[model samples]
Target: MNKRKIEVCLTPVLLPLYDIENSIVVVIDIFRATSSICYGIANGAEAIIPVAKVEDCLNYQQTDCLLAAERDGKVVEGFDFGNSPFAYTEDKVKGKTIVLTTTNGTYAISESRKTAYQVIVGSFLNLDAICNYLQKQDKDVLLLCAGWKNKFNLEDTLFAGAVVTQMGLDNFEYDDSAYAAEDLYLQAKDDLSGYTSKASHGKRMQKLNLEKDIAFCLNHNLTNVIPVLVGDKLVKM
Candidate 1:
């Protein structure tokens, strides 16, 4: 059997340093973006188109798409929704195509487009599905963290560690980054929501009165929706 390698890139800025040409890239934006993707798809959204910029999302306005745009934790004016997980409820998002843009998450997806062999969105909501999918691939796995503003953030790094821990691959080769992430996850696995609630991003969200969104994002395996990159949009597998 071929040895599979699992690695963690703490931030999108480090993606260029890795040879991800044919690797499985798991994009994690645990705070809201990837989490919202899970909720939206679970609630019956047709598909999600993640754009890197607000201007890119405007084109979708011509259609019946729901536009979710966020920058620096605030919903952009004139957009249909914000990055909050609760914003994607069954009644509102059902049967609609969502066009999304955010400060970090969408950019990470766009970055993985041409380089990665496969791109899968990861959040606590679909954590199990992501790990199960990677185990079956038997390919080198790279957990790409959609850190705040291309800078390292605790929540995303913790999510990377959680992935490494969940993968639990005996034959897996991982680097120091992965080692650190795994250790962090092991230390906090028992009270994941409590541990993450005090993170910087968590604090930021809390100040915005988004405790509900934070709680939803930190829940484990709430959904099995694994959003995979299909051309330019993300669709359920």
Candidate 2:
């Protein structure tokens, strides 16, 4: 056996336990959160500086940069945009600097950077491309999910499962929770749009009237740009 391990952790709680030294960290925050950040970079946004606090984004915006953020599935006050894919157009984001903050996603991204050798954002939008990158790297992998309000969210875990399945690796270990997530994704892969509409986080977005954004985020393999953390900003790798 090669002793390769694949660990899927729920949030900051399990984050510290994982030995991410020299490993690749796939941070997932489906439901139009991190997916929007990936799309922003893919569409030519210069870089994204993710902040855990809304105040931090506001402070950064003082430097004449664009600010985008969300909380409770709604756009934060005085922000240029919310965490939505439709907002990331070439006209708005191309060659621009984006300082973004979200309820749960960006915080996870910021925290994982400390332990991860390379932190990459993962979502349904860039599934195949991310998996392809992982295939070329030999390091251990940790799939970190930005769960809802400090609890496990289905969409992030499902996205992780999608990655595991797409990679098609046999030399890996899956905890019971990971197996459950993988199984959920396997069942939902055929109809991701339908799956998201029913997921807990998906329903939350639905109630907020952003159902279309959810659909866009669930569209798999739509991009090849891998957004990696470079210093304080996330740029295309």
Candidate 3:
């Protein structure tokens, strides 16, 4: 078995209880947040400043950066954008710095950054980038899933599984949570979009009339941008 250990944090609520110090934390909010961040970078954003609260993002907006804020899966009032990948088009975010606040993803990122030795944003959009980076870091990993409103969500958990399975497969031993995530991912590997369509969060987005986003978030390895935390900002590595 490989010596490296990887743990998947299925939800953000449990982040406070975990001892993640000195470990690599991969934050996943596949439905939108991280995916949007990746798009923002790949499309050419200089950096992304992830804030937990809309007010914090608002504070940054005075600095000439684009702001995107979301609350409960919808665009927050008076923000330039919401937590949607398509909203981060080249015409909008390219060559600019963005301040982003999402309901769950950005909150999880702020929380996980507290003690993680290194924090990297992950999403299906940059899946291969994350897997390749983990292979080199050689540290214990915690896939911090930004679950829907701090509760467990299938899409995030599945992305974590994709990471673990890609980085080493059965070569490394992991906790029950990692195993469970892997199992779920394997079951859905052949049809990720189809599988995730049934998820609660998926249904939630559908209610919001964001059906195209669900498929966009599931598209894999489209970009090689691996967003790494560099002094309170996420920039491409």
Candidate 4:
């Protein structure tokens, strides 16, 4: 029997199911995590190693990796950069190894490592690239959303909808929340942020004066890099 592609929405409240034995895990944290990775790879970061904790990223700092981490929308005390796309630049990141840890996205990715055959990070910036890759692969793909502090967020779900819609999967099942996200994405169409930013995480980022970041995260297909997790790092493919 063909394995089913799963769409799992992960929040701090819902327990993480990272048992990725043979599936592809597409981790989505649209507010910043995936967006930053996309920026880093697009701007020329040779590879991004996504660690579960700041210490893991730090361990690599002595080696070839440039650390980038954030907690609660702020830079971690000792990382090289925070979880912001703006930090990645052609001049700074080109040919560099970026080690990243984020409050939600990294943790979600780490958890997904258990079950996914391959764990790939996803964002609106690389939407088309991700979809195009998935279309050619035969594995059952899982869409994992890194929700805010254990609560469901709209932006990640909308991204999931955008992905599933574009893939045109024939055998798919949506839980209540997944269906809601799909419906919301359709309702919003091209105005993604307007549709999903109603979530607390989006509002909090905006409150912190990051409306531009929100807009940037909502732009579909702006980048061509597909960040795939290799062993412990997410590298451009």
Candidate 5:
């Protein structure tokens, strides 16, 4: 049998270089956005509508969907909340739809939605579940990191690395980016939180006094829920 291929795109800006035609694209935004999505879904959110722009999220305010918009790591002035995982508790998200827009995560989803065979949200929160799901798909995989402002960020890359490592290297043919990500994962696997604390976004979160949110986002296997993009919204799969 032919081995499935796996590649990692370090930033949204580099997404165009990869051919996503037959690949399952997993969008990673470990700082908060994707993490919150997983938490919300696990908490029973009906669905999450991810829009590329804050203005798009605001447009949903007239509907029953909860509006969430984040820019520069802070909640937009008029939104209900930012991308913090704690804000996605069952009490708030249950049985309701959430419209989310963030600095990098939503943009990454918008770009990948145009061509990938399938798009799914991935993060440390659902690490093992995602790996198991990918192994069953028998398709090439693309780990697309929602880097800070279209530039590479360590947390997203580290989560990509974790997924590649968890999936086991022997199962698929992978590229240099995959190997590099695995190498990074191997080096930091023993101390994910400690190692990623040095990331640029990590420092920014610290400055914003969001250390609790950082800790929550980095925790592994918090839920088995995998958020798959169905049309414009993400629903549990």
Candidate 6:
């Protein structure tokens, strides 16, 4: 049998170089967006609607959905919350639908939704579940990182590395980027928080006094909920 191929696109800007039509694209935004999505879905939120613009999220204001918008590491004025995972507690989001817009993550989802064979939210929070699901799917995989404002960021790359490491290399062919990510993961696996503290986004989060949020987003296997894009929204799969 031929081995399935796995490639890592370090940033959404480079996504056009990959053949996503036949590959399951795992959208990763480990700083906060995808992490929060996994947390919210696992906590019983019905669905998360990811929009590319803050204005797009505002259109849902009259509806029952919860509105969340984050830009430049801070909550956008007039939104219920930012992309912090702590804001997704079960007591607040259970049975509710959330509309979320972020600086990078949602934009990556919007860009890939039309082309990828499958688009699923990924983060360290659901690492094992994602790896196990990919093993059973038998499809080529694209680890799409939602870098900070279309530029490469360390946290997302590290999570991509973690996935590549967890997925193992025996049954799959990998690209140069995949090998590089795996190497990075192996080097930092023992102390992810300590290693990521040097990342640009991590430093930005620190400037914003979000050390706890950064810590929580880096935790592994916190949930089994995999958020798969279904039309315009992400529902637990």
The reply for model 6, stretches above 4 Å from the true place, is none
lDDT of 3 by residue, 179-209 (tens): 8998899999999988998999899999999
Instruction: Please write out the lDDT profile of model 6 over residues 98-184, one tens digit for every residue.
Output: 999999999999989989999999999999999999999978999999999999988898888888887877888889989999999
Q: Which stretches of candidate 1 lie over 4 Å from their true place?
A: none
- List the candidates ranked by lDDT, beginning with the highest: 6, 5, 1, 3, 2, 4
Put down candidate 2 lDDT per residue, 111-168, tens digits, no spaces: 9998688999998778889988887788777889999887888788888898777655
Error of 3 at 216 (Å): 0.6
Ranking by TM-score: 6, 5, 1, 3, 2, 4
* TM-score per candidate, chains pooled: 0.96, 0.95, 0.96, 0.89, 0.98, 0.99
Residue 77's lDDT within candidate 4 is: 86
lDDT by residue for model 1 over 21-126, one digit each (tens)? 7799999999899999987888888899999999999988789889999998889999888788888889998888899999999999999887898999999998
Stretches of model 3 off by over 4 angstroms after superposition: 169-171
| Predicted candidate 5 versus true structure: per-residue lDDT over 105-162, tens digit per residue | 9999999999999999998899999999999997899999999998988888888888
Q: List the residue pairs that clash in candidate 5.
A: none
Measured by TM-score, how close is model 4 to the native structure?
0.89
RMSD of each: 1.1, 1.4, 1.4, 2.3, 0.8, 0.7
List the pairs of residues colliding in candidate 1. Answer: none
Error of 4 at 20 (Å): 3.8
What lDDT does candidate 2 reach at residue 153?
80
What TM-score should be assigned to candidate 6?
0.99
Error of 1 at 200 (Å): 1.4
